[model samples]
Target: MRRPGSGTRRLAGARVPVRVRGRGRDHGSAAVEYLGFLPLLLLVALAGVQLGLAAYAAQQAGTAARAAARTAAQRERADGAEQAGRAAVSAWVAQRSTIGGTGGCPGDAVTVTVTVTIPSVFPGVDAFGPVHRSATMPCDESN
Candidate 1:
């Protein structure tokens, strides 16, 4: 037997309270949990993007270094090695990069070094520093 408008039911003439599962007690819990975890998820995503940017910057630095070294190896283009290095990378990367090197045609080889600051996704955060890459090329004996 059961009573109307009551949570209890009669079993063998004894009243027992009905136990409810996953009712109003847990309402909106998922939304709350998701809200709590949202910040962490965003942070992880931002970190991944930042890491990718750093890798790109490193790759750009390497390209710049190689371009500069190759240009410096030729006596006729040695003076434009820095300009050549800057032109080899993206505008954004070149804007924050520095190129320096030694050696030229008379020498056995030419070496060039490029340093670029890693761009940050987070404002005012510089957790990752500059990326540096160096390259060497044989001098052009004919030049």
Candidate 2:
């Protein structure tokens, strides 16, 4: 049908303009979405860091156990055996690992057991518990 603009004015009066509905262009939509998801990203990053730290601690524990066992097996049950082992591994660890035990690793067949309590990066969350790493080495029987 010819509209009034085309010189045909019949049906209704002047045609009412159709209003565009719904939402307009969201200029800040991406920014808003990223802001909403930032917290989750940060949490994941912190968890990753915590996992790395735990793994490092576990490796250090194993190193300490091996070193202690080797030293104690051949040594004369000296007082510095345990301290040396603890220091050797603490060089890599966070200096917070609890390393100590009786001179049980001073026999022909020495066994050193290292235990470390993993620290948490996130509060109130314990992903990995205490880790225990042990090593045993035969003594130098030749004295």
Candidate 3:
């Protein structure tokens, strides 16, 4: 008996509610909440990436150190310990990584150290220091 969308449904003497609202006071606030939380989301993502980079750097350092020690342990390969270590790692990492060694096979054992800078996920951020790993191998009898 009422016209379509008459804009109002007036009863005898009271005005009827025309617009339906959600039961909660914060209805339709999903978009606003997400926008407000965007910074936190970005921060978490960057932290995850940075963590991965640090782990990778540590692993690379270990690998390089082991390779260097092994090479140095061999009398024939002692001269190329550092080079062997560098060759064992990825080019990018080797470029940024530093290699060192001490206690050669000439004495009793060979030890090598690898230090790799932790790459950053965010530009211009170098808050992290280098990852270090050391390896030692018994010297070959010939050495």
lDDT of each residue in 1-102, candidate 2, tens digit only: 643333433348775555344345566898999999999999999989998989888889988887777677765664455776787775546365655552
Ranking 1 against 2 by TM-score, winner: 1
For TM-score, the strongest prediction is 1
- Tell me, by lDDT, which candidate is best: 1
Off by over 4 Å in 1: 1-7, 17-19
Candidate 1 lDDT tens digits, 78-113: 988999999999999999999988445667988888
The TM-score obtained by model 2 is 0.73
Cα lDDT for residue 1, model 1? 69
Clash pairs, model 1 backbone: none
**Candidate 2: stretches off by over 4 Å:** 1-24, 91-94, 100-107
- Higher-ranked by lDDT: 1 or 3: 1
- What lDDT score is found at residue 99 in candidate 1? 93
Q: For each candidate, C-alpha RMSD in Å?
A: 2.9, 6.2, 3.8
User: Which whole-number lDDT from 0 to 100 does residue 62 have in model 1?
Assistant: 98
TM-scores vs. true structure, each candidate: 0.85, 0.73, 0.80
Preferred candidate (lDDT higher): 2 or 3: 3
